[model samples]
Target chain A: MPYHFYNTISQLRQNEELVLYDRVLHFSEEDEQLVKDFLKIEYETESLNYPFTPPSCNAAAALWGAKTVYTACQLILYRENKEAELPLLLPVYNNEMDAAAILSADLCLRFLPQALQQTKNIDPDDALIAVLENHLQQWHYSGIGYVLNAATVNFDTVFANECMQQLYIDRVIQKKDMQRAMLPLLQKKITAAMGIYSATFWKELNSDKTHE
Target chain B: MAEDTSNHLVYWMQLDLVHKDYLAQIRHWDNLKIAADEQSIWVKDFTTSQLESIVLKSIPFTHLYYCKDNLLFPKSSLLPVGKQPAFLWTPIERALPVTLQGFNHNFFGIQQQQALRLAPIEEEQKVTVLLATVQDAGNYILNAPSIRLQQLKWIFINNKDALIIGEPVLPVNGRSYWQKGRFIFPVGYAFEFTVLEKIAAQQIDSTGTHLIWWIDEASYCLLHPDVLQPLSIASWRQTISNSPHKI
Candidate 1:
């Protein structure tokens, strides 16, 4: 067999096992109902008033679950406001928050060290990681199950879902390491797609943060 | 054949004598060493040295530009809406260097008909600027009397005024063909409607009716041959008219 064929075979085996494992792990009556409702709305071919599907709903769910695990592991992470309530998170799964997440992740990777080097009072990296975890949880609750379920039915849907899953894994792992390791790959892909590379938007909570 | 030196001259005459072997290499090496030695040397000096033996780039054609807020309707073809006052440009194609420079120098000499007052075109989005056939223009340039030559570029009208301003850059998405060293005034019905709407908005004043200036940085004046002769005369005339108008 050709090298590529073996590589592909191994990848396919891993993916199938992943899908089975995810189904076993995330499946529940509540998740199934939410997925069914979202799918009905999303797959409605003839509806004139369909709500906008958020960007990468499936990917958001995987991130959400992963982040919940991370937060529970970290112990210091906690819900500080009612804003952490799940409703606010649905928008993130809707792609409304994707750009913000991407930008935050980009900035944290870029400026956090410089910020730490200059001042000891703040660890923006921890805050950034917390935000990422929150968004991941939102995605887990919002729409990842629908996408994974849809994947079993449509190959294209599955491909898109799997690609985002791979990207999430890649980005999260790279985030844990450093942007220098992963940003170029993300930038190359994004630039290929959009002709522009952009970081996430950070909403400053306080006006008095010292300028870099 | 006699060379025509009436327009701007971009010629290829003599740049082939530079030594292209060891001398060029040694010069390049020397320059590299000097540049590395001092980073503060001005870029202009560097360019002057780099281009010391380069051949001049040739222009494909010489063009004459006539700009006005309103161009008159030629005496013959008068549509009711077209009869309105408008500024029109006439490009004299393939102008000789002397004539081109002459017109550039003496634009005011060109006589204006009662209907054809020269004014800057304003907000001329998609206006119909004129184009005359070379044969028709040639006859005017070569055969028209001096007074007529001075008035070579004129707008004529039967019932209404003749002058319209610049056309708007059309709401477009693609790269403009005009961007590629070409003229880009609107033409036909769309052109006429744009000119009409813009002219209807002009505020007349004592000096003359004001016109919109659609001067683009990388724009060329495209002229017809007939328009060129008069434009040169008019340009000279304008200078004369403006220079401390003899008491």
Candidate 2:
């Protein structure tokens, strides 16, 4: 009952997701270096204090890493199964703060996989949602989907329903909107599964903002 | 009437004559003394033999005609038969006299008047009276010695009427003809003909006629009228027809 454990620690430690995501995003050498340096710092610091724990060691780092991974996977999925899914998750932010918060979240998400590998016993899904909720209170309303995406093992009905309820209570999502967004993935109408998490995450955020 | 088989290309330009009174005013008027001013005056100094030597040596033509302005002349033609003129004039002493005594007519006086009278009457007078054949005319004029004249009017005859040719005017600074720069022909052949102009002994303000003989498309000479003679057009036709070679 570790919440939605899909990848083993060894697989997460490989950082393959992050590497492929960097390639997909066409990150410049400097940007890649920056992200790598940030992750290495976060991991080294977090590992020094909590030698056995990963997801629980640095909530900020894990969340940033998870968002980054989720964004990359979403873009990949959008490229593959764009015709079926709702067109959400575009890089449009409300302002500079929103853009920066999203960037920070992506960086946190980028570190999550490796963090997950290091942690001994922590529900990654619960830990990630907690970090995203914490960031949501402080930062502008963006990047919530990426955090949730990193927490869930895949974009399944249970995870989507839970994410929809949480966002609704937080005033980040509108009522009666969860099914239209989650149906494509539930019915297997969405050809690509990689981006399902972030896609649902952003769609819920947009729905909340529309109702507000 | 007959097909002109000569490979030579010729065009004639009428030579303007200085008035008889104007010729009298300039006492020492000679071919070498003629400047660029009086170029229209007829030159009557060249002898038939001198003209022949210059024409034959410089130009490759067999015969040259010295005809009158009144004669019914055929349009100038370049027949597709003969060889290009290849003769080169040998350099001679530069102090030769302009007038040669071998002529049988008072060519300068009568012909000058005829040219003057014809000047207003006919369009032919306005055209350049040139007798050209496909020959190396440049070599002859450039290498031949300078000929001195008292007046620019020099003429020759082929039995019926007078034919006129004159020398180009000398540069004003009394510079030797050799110092006056070289003349280049259109045929890309260049020689120092001005070196033959006798400038040291005589200096006059009179400009004489500047005659151009195009030996070929590219080769031609801007010479004094003394360098060429006008042959009878009829005789030229007869000679070409009679010759074994079509030139």
DockQ of each: 0.00, 0.00
Which tens-of-lDDT digit does each residue in A56-152 have in candidate 2?
A: 2333433344433444344433344342231232222233332223333433443433333332134444333343333333332233332333333
Candidate 2 lDDT over residue span B149-193, tens digit each: 111232222222222222332111111111122221222222333
Model 2 segments beyond 4 Å from truth?
A: A1-15, A18-100, A108-212, B1-59, B62-247
> Each model: TM-score of chain B?
0.16, 0.16
**Position B192, candidate 1: lDDT:** 29
DockQ of candidate 1 relative to the true structure: 0.00
| lDDT at A69, model 1 | 30
Judged by whole-model lDDT over C-alpha atoms, candidate 1 comes out at 0.28
Which numbered prediction scores highest in TM-score against the true structure?
Answer: 1
Runs of candidate 1 exceeding 4 Å displacement: A1-35, A43-182, A196-212, B1-195, B199-247
